[model samples]
Target chain A: MRTCLIVDDSRVVRTVARRILEELQFSSREAGDGQAALAACQEEIPDFVLLDWNMPVMNGLDFLRALRQLPSVRQPIVIFCTTENDINHIQQAIEAGADEYIMKPFASDVLQAKLVQVGLL
Target chain B: MQAADFQFLSALIKERSGIALSSDKTYLLENRLGPLAAQRRLNDIAGLVAQMRSVRDEELIRDVVEAMTTNESLFFRDGKPFELLRTVILPRIVAARPKERPLRIWSAACSSGQEAYSIAITLLEEEGLLAGRPVEIVATDIATSMLIKAKAGVYSQFEVQRGLPIRLLLKYFAQKGTNWEIAPRLRSMVSFRQHNMLGECAGLGRFDIVFCRNVLIYFDEPTKKGVIERIAQVLAPDGVLLLGAVETIIGLSTRLEIVPGAAGIYRPVGSGPRAAVA
Candidate 1:
């Protein structure tokens, strides 16, 4: 089964994302912040990462930048999920190597479509 | 809400709009028409039916028909068809058509214009696919209210969120308070009009591509066949038709045949092998 690392500070957001990813037939691992997400990545790289923008210890953009530098043959497809909808943020995320980006408060259908667009599902 | 009333309303709606309302749609009728009844000062659906029978209120009938028709749509509702259009169909059409003749697309039953606008965005994003060739999009619907909203090109935040990628949303739309209005460049490429699928389509002229997705499922078998035949008439010999993912033309009309390896894409039958795309 494809594994996903869901990085978010809020437990509610992580739980909701986990449930939706489960329905999409993906096994998920949760990280409270970017620091822990980085640690999880070092231990075992996931097929996909649902990263949040703002968090304590390490922000999403910082984590994405750091994740791209790591020495590995298989890099996870990063999808930046956040409440941020500005063009500057989206451009930065794409520049930082996010395969796709989706706005928060999204439904299951939206997530599935994004996944399909990224060829992760 | 009674059986007889339901039958009468369903029959009336089917006759007027070619939308078949099955028996299980009782709750749908009540849910949609309930507020309409209250607005007209009727107690319930039963009273609404009686009003319809007693007097020939053309406006009231039009309102009821509009209410029952589903206008639910989203940007890039299904990703595959649009992807196919970008990679396979448009390239072939652009290469085949003469530069003097502009490419024409018809979005039949386009609710609030998302499909047509999505098509416009696809073309715009292609950069040099059209080169210097012109393109035109004609979007039509049976509901005047939908056409009005479509022409305005304004969408609520919720409406824009569904099936619309964040990047494209940021690139193509400008924020207006809580809503987003489409760019004028994209708006100008498409023209919105009120049209019924069952009516004559020859007046609209021939189209290189027709998007008639999702609407035909509401029609009965006979109605579906008639609409398809009419579309076949207006479809250019080398044109393509896109239907809903689950919709099929089998057992309906022989004027069109499915394009092998392409789901939901059809071409005019015996139109020569030039219509096929790699």
Candidate 2:
């Protein structure tokens, strides 16, 4: 099964993401912040990463840049999940190598579409 | 059926129900109406059409039209539009409405009442925002069979399983043996009626938000334009219209414009043609 790394600060958010990912038949590991996420990535690269924007100890953009520079050859398809929806923020996230961005409070359909767009499902 | 019978049936359907049927739909007619033919003891579609042409049987005509019109729908089908309704449209309308006036929503061509009930679920979930404001959900459909099922608000497990989230299924539904029924209170929030889209809509009154999704694609250009024109009349000045994800009013009507940042959502243009359908 494909593996996913979920990086989010809120327990509720992480739990919801995990449930949805697991339902999609993905094995997952979680990190509370970007530092932990980077460490996990260094240990083993996941096929997908559902990253949050506003976590402490290293924000999402910085972590994304660091993750890209990892010595590992495979690059996980990153999806940035956040409440920020303006054009500039979305553009910046795309430039920072996010495969897609979904607004918070999205239903499973949206997640499924994003996964399909990224060819993960 | 022969080509002549197919042509007659297509013309009859268009005139009766405003549904434009093309030659490609011969298979569709065969698939959907073949059993109706057997019940009527007709040899085939050609025989059914011959009987209808000869006698103009009203019941057979109704059955034929209803069968041809697709009623495929599910709870929360294509989730973004509902998300937009819950997050943006409802809050905007509530904040703008006067204190005493109740919010009105119409699910036009509401198939099996899932669209209307889905709207109710959203309103119920956002009770804190409502703050005692009243809300009415009016759902209308052309198919009486679908209306009956919609009014009952009951579904088989397989029906509920499609497009309905597990969390919502647990919260708003009660188990009836192997099936599930919508809670009485939630079912009561919506009112269903057997109203044809081609008929007068003034009797339904005005609505703040109208869900007319996935209904226009079946119509010819003229019928589609006519239906949308009538819809524009019954919509409140500031109200919005939500169409199917693939549908749009861009080429069909000039009175409505798509809302920026929201796909398939539209608002009426004040300066455009507002002439009533004669």
Candidate 3:
């Protein structure tokens, strides 16, 4: 089973991902914001990351940029699961090093597809 | 004069392999073709082009292509794939197999044979399921000369030192003069041959693991699709197909799916779980 870390301010979003990941036999951990995510990343690196874009403390893009800069962290398949799906927005996440892109309110299959594309599935 | 020679080599490579060198790589063009010019008793690059164009000697054309082909490789090149293979792929396969049988591997487009030998050495040092199995690793390249050098299995100290850990170097290789030659048993495990990715690969058999990494970057879209399709046909249903990190089969062919987070690692089209299969 793969390991996934879901970072979102929304309790509902994190709960939903927890269910989906659990169903997929993925061990999961959650962080309410980017700072928590970064800390959890240091504690134990997950094989995949579901990073919400517009979060408090540090936004997803900043978090991703900083995450990539961390020497201890290896490259993990990360997706920007955000409400923002604009082409330029998607491109920004990619430039910041997201492995895949998925919009918010994504179905389980869409989440599955994103994970598969980056080799998490 | 240099301009005339540059275009000649570029056009030859384009026609021969369908790989168009951007007009800007004049230095590379000159460097790769300079030796061929000397061999033909030519004074300069222009004279060499004239000789090559005169007869269209297919044998000489093959020689030019072999000479021009990029032979860049290092031990433990792209270190992560080997890590994944040891910690992830090999054990999964060994457990899934029915009995203690020989496992098969093919390193398609195995340039200068570093990738194949890396895999071999990794298996030799590996613990658990892969430790005991008899593995036949077929390493094929498009360049006959490269295959010959690969068959020699000798490396200068510098070449051996890179990508290879000191511990492994002490264990797997023996010093001959200033060079290191792979142990005979390890050398026997890898069979090197010439293989063209764009041509018929029907003669080559199937493999449980295929490492065609970084090879398709040189091919056009059609050639890439054709080569990948042919490999898909020969890859075992449960096998792994590794491509370069930036490369993907996306929107090209649906037969293989990404093995998420493993970079370009792919599973045979429909073999993985529903999550993996689109």
Candidate 4:
């Protein structure tokens, strides 16, 4: 079972994603914000990280940047989950090393495609 | 406007955003850029793009992109989901748990706090469910601006009416001109914060009833798998997973034994989590 880290600040988003993941058959972990996410990583490293873009106390972009800075933590494959649909924002996420970008209110099929696109599936 | 320009624009939008614009939205694109192009005295979008690349007004680039991103939100747009929460879900959750255990509920993509507040109103009404109890809701979102707004707990009347009932509007909220603020007591019941669906969920502990409704459908298959796996980790064994009306876990994981008689509910079959069993 692949252990995954859900990095987001919204509890509901975390819960919903967690529920979906449970249905998918992968073991999961969660963090509420970027700061907490980093801390969670220390306790138990995850196979993949689902990073959100906007947040307090370290947004997703900053978190991704910070994650790259640490050499000890084995980096997980990440996909940017956000509602920002601008070209530059998408390019920026890709530039920041995100394997893919997903929009908000997306259907499960679309999310699955993005996962496969990024090779995490 | 031209065939090639429209194709380029569509490709750019698709690449940058997952919104699948229909073929008839050509004028909508025109509307988005017309004012700016007119203000710059440019004859057309080509002139504007050329000028933008030359002078590179970074703010303009940002503004344009920001405008394109969809931030549309409303209070309780979907009534049936909340109906399930107040009527069917909460009762089962309370009955399944041991006494004195704190009830934790999460609202996944809590846009501007309305959904969380809606839950609060519903909880407040069910006196016996939480008469002398502790039930804290953790409301989170990925938008910083929205989180700030959610924390404020204020909304215009128009913002309130989308799904708010009149009884709730009168009782749990206070009038502030055209806007209404959810009562302080109701506001305090929820812990609002910034969260992304693609990261770690720490310090949140576990939840009995999770309202992660209608936030998925944006990720890829692997991301979905990864998300489900993580959710299973923190969920209490019998904890119920509530998804959007259109969402499901049919092709997903094996951890959750699909609960019979429930449309969108799933739970762990065996002993919940072995790590915490002892």
For candidate 4, give the lDDT of residue B136.
86
Ranking according to DockQ, highest score first: 1, 2, 3, 4
User: Residue-wise lDDT of candidate 2 within A13-97, one digit each (tens)?
Assistant: 9999999999999999999999999999999999999999999999888899899888788899998888764445656877788
- Per-residue lDDT for B121-172 in model 4, tens only? 8888886876566888999876666788889999864465455544455667
| lDDT assessment of candidate 3 | 0.78
Candidate 2 colliding pairs: none
Alpha-carbon lDDT of model 4: 0.68
Error of model 3, residue A82, in angstroms: 53
Point out the worst 10-residue segment of candidate 4 chain A by lDDT: A109-118
lDDT of 4 at B247: 74
- Give the number of the best model, judged by DockQ: 1
Better of 2 and 4 by DockQ: 2
The best candidate by TM-score is: 1
Of candidate 3 chain B, the 10-residue stretch with the lowest lDDT total is B269-278
TM, every model: 0.94, 0.71, 0.66, 0.54
> What is every candidate's C-alpha DockQ against the true complex, given to 2 decimals?
0.42, 0.04, 0.01, 0.01
Query: What is the CAPRI rating of model 1's predicted complex?
Result: acceptable
Best by lDDT: 1
Q: Residue-wise lDDT of candidate 1 within B1-278, one digit each (tens)?
A: 79999999999999889999999989999999999999999999999999999999999999999998999899988878789889998999988988888899999999999999999999999959888788999999999899999999999867887777767887899877667899999999999888988799998989999999999899999999999999999998999999999999988999999998888999998875677353
Task: Identify the runs in model 1 with alpha carbons over 4 angstroms from their true place.
Answer: B276-278
Q: Which stretches of candidate 4 lie over 4 Å from their true place?
A: A1-121, B1-72, B269-278
- Model 2 lDDT tens row, B1-278: 69998998899889877888889888998998899999999998888988998996888899998898898888888888888888787777667667688888999999898889989998999998788898899999988889999999998755665566544766798877656799998998999998899998999999888999999999999999999999999988788889999998888888888777688888887622221100
List, residue by residue over A1-121, the lDDT tens digit for candidate 3: 7899999999999999999889999999999989999998888888988999999998899889988988874766787788764546766887788877665555676676555545565
Mark the regions of model 3 whose C-alpha exceeds 4 Å error after superposition. Answer: A1-121, B1-8, B274-278
Q: Could you tell which candidate, 1 or 2, scores higher by DockQ?
A: 1
